[model samples]
Target: MRANLKTANLKSGDLPGDVTHHPYDAYGLPLMVEPASPALAKDPLAVQSWFAEHHRTLEALLPTYGGVVLRGFAIPDTMAFNAMIQCYDTDPNGYAGGLTPRKNIAGKVFEASRVPADQKIILHQEMGYLPSFPKMVAFYCLKPSETGGCTTIGDMRRFQKQIPANLLDAVHERGVLYRRNYRAPGPVSDPLVALFRREWTDVLQVETVEQAEEACRAVGCEAVWEDDGSLSMRYRSSGFVNHSVTGEEVWFAQVQGMHFNQARLAQNYDTLNKAFPGGRPRPIEILFGDGGDIPEDMVTPLYDILDRLAVNLPYEHGDFMLLDNIYTAHGRQPFTGSRDVQVGLVF
Candidate 1:
């Protein structure tokens, strides 16, 4: 194992089995962890020990690095991956009221978003729009895509700096309001039903609309029943937040991800336009806290900044990545073939 002068004091014993760290020159110096010894890569127990020995140093590096990619570990299955995560954080968060459609694998581990491979998910902090969110998010690659399924990450600090100063000030002063419409599932012949396959019951995990409303209220959202028995909810949240450890201001909202103009929502628009002669309202919308429309001109520049700052991290089978949720924003690139990634959250 090579000695790291910065973390030399934190070293416990001669690092087990030749693990190596590589630093990247992105917005934050993101680290890449790899095994130098082939035998070490195949042994989950040895990797777990290595992580435990350097736990303190890893925690300290997170604020500066934003995240780390642990490759060549050959984590065998969900059980082994969960074991590795427990080394850093024992408390795993369950996926409740999560926007994406995912199935739990074991304990708190889940299949990553089941969105179509052709869709490109926009960059945003994980569940940043919610009243509560995990402090850290980790992804384990069980199977890598044959082509184009890189997980793109953006440094929140850099994104904050790159955006327009006036827009940033406006968001800070007014915050943001998120609106979502959930319709009931029905025959595909119905346009609205086809558009939003997810029903309110599925999202709230409740049998009744009253229970759904109560659940919304618990999460600080205002819920109203539409004339067609659909549920509409609005949540107000800050566009920026302070990093839990460093207290640095970070761009932490779902503006780009939920915005209609973004590529991620392009398919929704197409479906809606085809169903209705006139355009249908966006299922999700982001507005200024005062309910004022966020100018498209302002949003355009932020998208540009995100594009400029994003770093694409392609996955290899058995690769694992841990991200400081407040410091980094993540997304997915459009891919072909099968891509199986699992996620676990640390709260």
Candidate 2:
């Protein structure tokens, strides 16, 4: 017989079954699960098989909770995590034209993000700027830092409702446009600029501009070559998208995270403005679909909403989290010691 699972809003305590469910917070933002049986917790294969057996229930849970965390599992490393993800989703997404730098670890798993440990990556949906993106994303914590380094998450549905009605009306009317700049590998005068940006060849996994343009076009983006050996790719998408399961229009853009006023780069805003041409052409730009500036008023309140709703989901060794990409947004908090979180996505 399958191990039964029950949901509740209670403090940490033992359940009578093989699995226990707990809410991380008041909003029940991420439903947390752990093995209640010693045998289930000791055997990795049993945990994996349990996940496979309850895949449908888990799928149903995600639409309501947005995210699910399976902690205290016996999975050993990145390879085991990849195998477990394969049990749920066979088709893994390729990270082409991805913003953050990552290294492929196992079959479909990759380093969560190579952003420096000191910087906070603000909450944003995975591949939100792209036309086609992952439908679901999963993270496996091979190791946790000694301090901090929580995987921050926010409910997009809440974020959407928080936005002022006027701003939502404007976004619905104008849509959102995103632009990304890519430069070729070369000696950069500023080390800071190099640290934030990546080369076009590396991002597209192609050697020539022609190949890069082709790749960009395939993904519904328009690529333009700059006079200064740089590439600009533009895409237009709705600021809000309907949640696949809930049918609720959820906030689903990268504007807040890509903006210069982002948590990590806000302090260097002026200096970064001076680093690039036009005084404000950061690596990425978010604008109205018609190439107009998104009003400052609209952008400012969003950060506040995200900050108010942000919940840091602390990591532990062998903890696995699955998120519905359309319903949730995720980020990274600053850390002290080493942290290894491998991630995988399915389109």
Candidate 3:
């Protein structure tokens, strides 16, 4: 089968068998790959083999490109996508103790975050707050939205360079602390409980508070059981991480989503204010490692930098994107109509 692979602005190279590389854009935001022969679509084994041959190439290019989009291969369903990802990551990681509420669609394949379509999710690296996280994240688009829905990506390396020097120094020196409170599951009719996608039970995946605390401790989070059956979890980590491959320090925290005054949380805060007129503390908050509030002055410019550098990737059915989670952060845009994106994480 003829396989045409393109790296951004790089010339085609001779490879074993029928595979060929083609030059694309200079930025390499998403180097696209496609099969030259249509017959390859029907042979899953051949497709898998072809991708396996180029696995090292993809890994080497991922840090430089930030991401890669494979198109026109006719990845029929989640099962097919799962097989494809296995070529790169033999054992993809499962979503356990994950913050987002997602259903497992197949082995290691999960439905993307279950947030309201109208709400924009702030750009964040997957599981960035946790001590350990996936090295790569793959998204397979099953269906495309009618309008506005696009997976947004930002280069953390670029964000790191452009961010204010003082803020960078502060975060690097003091780190970031994330505070999350998971309330006990309430009746389905309760709007407040509905807003919190998962309860302490679901998040901890255990029946009793003791087990929950143990699970939290395993992940390096300090947990406390509240008087009202709520669970409070606190963890601290640096805002920047050295890219596993590039060794460049990248902005790696969830400050955009965790900070109270950021635009990303403005809608949630407005809803919360209307629900509780007296104003209640947010279910999640971010602070300095020493527990001081993050200054709005720091957050405002960070938000602006993310906005300026964000790349909105419009989805098409059967498209698959694999991202280097360390150097790239992903988010969702407000959308209308039906959209289905499945995700698989690689450790």
Candidate 4:
């Protein structure tokens, strides 16, 4: 802890900080919670004390760091609640490869897990891919890898700070390319194009340039088509996306488009799924920093900026990390070993 500095108060103790503010730099910092005593952890009253004290503390601390991790915090519920255990279990196409299939606890809630599962998980706030993203996210590990599954975070707001202004201006003005290849869309309806459509020349159902333009129009934006039959677009649109409680404008990309890294997004994403049997999706690849198609000039600086703000901490048998949606972006650190965890995506 940075002695004498302030903290965000959550339900229980102090959390961390916000590295930057213009709505794009993430708002909270990550806290590697100082571990409490083992014997006291077993005391029910003591357990209650830990949970109860952290929230308020973290809230005050949220303004300082990008997110926080309650290290060594045990998840007593090896088997989550029945409602949790049954749902969102199976989404054949919704998530990337290697996630356990489970049912939703409710219409839009998370279910629980049975076996101890361990594998490094990638990041993207719950569902922030296009537009329908989550506002806050957290995870509690009932069991951690004897070896891997560390968490990596990217503060998009901070990420944008590193994104050259010229690129930002281009996105705001010239727009970017965006290609989404989904054979089957999630139950959540698409705001722009109908998920079901005819098989085009490729013998596959895809959102064509025309359809993408129509979808863009629906969202009050314009779309253009490249000669190669790809879609290009931009958004000057705005809405009341203030955090449900804060009403503050979220620090996010102006809109979704190819401007960010179209070739790269398409490159990293293996839509054909030609290799995996069940046709597994690849891990989430969102680079405000550099990985795939980021331009040469932007690579070194962007990575440095991101590396400064983002933090990646491996999971433990009993650890919990809470993320403030407005401030941070997170991902997986490639690793090898048993890494099992159960999730509770609370609003």
Best by lDDT: 2
In candidate 2, clashing pairs total 0
Candidate 4 per-residue lDDT, tens place, 1-347, comes to 11122233232232322111122233434645544467334543444455554455543444346566665333455332223223222332222211234444333334332223332333334433334444455565665556545566766655665666755654444332223322222333433223221112121223454554455554333344445343333233221144444344443542222223333234533432232112221211223321223253543344446557656566666565656666666655545555555455433
Return the TM-score for each candidate structure: 0.87, 0.91, 0.87, 0.53
Rank order by lDDT, top first?
A: 2, 3, 1, 4
lDDT of 2 by residue, 1-347 (tens): 01123332212332336788988979887989888877667888887777777655665677667788988878888777887887544233367778877868878788888888988888999888988877778988988998889999988888888888877888789888898898877778888678666788888778987899898987778998877788888899988787655556777878787755534367777777677645444588888888888766667888778889999988889999988888889998899998998898766
User: Which residue pairs in candidate 3 collide?
Assistant: none
What C-alpha lDDT values do all the predictions have?
Answer: 0.73, 0.78, 0.74, 0.41
| Candidate number that wins on lDDT, 2 or 3 | 2
lDDT of 1 by residue, 109-205 (tens): 8888888898877788887767777787889998889999988888888787777877888989999988777776444567575545467777777
Best by TM-score: 2
RMSD of 4: 10.8
Q: Where does candidate 3 have its weakest 10-residue lDDT segment? A: 1-10
lDDT of 3 by residue, 1-347 (tens): 01113432222343334433432345557666666656555666676677677665666667667777777776877788888876544222245467777878887788999889988887889988778787888899999899977888888878878878878889988999987878876666667656753587887678887888888877778887677677878889987777666556778878877777736556566776454333333467778898888887888777888888788878888888888898888999999999999998887
Residue 24 in candidate 4, Cα distance off native in Å:
22
Give candidate 4 misplaced runs (Cα > 4 Å): 1-28, 35-40, 44-56, 78-123, 146-148, 173-179, 184-250, 254-308
The whole-model C-alpha lDDT of candidate 3 against the native structure comes to: 0.74
Question: What order do candidates take by TM-score, descending?
Answer: 2, 3, 1, 4
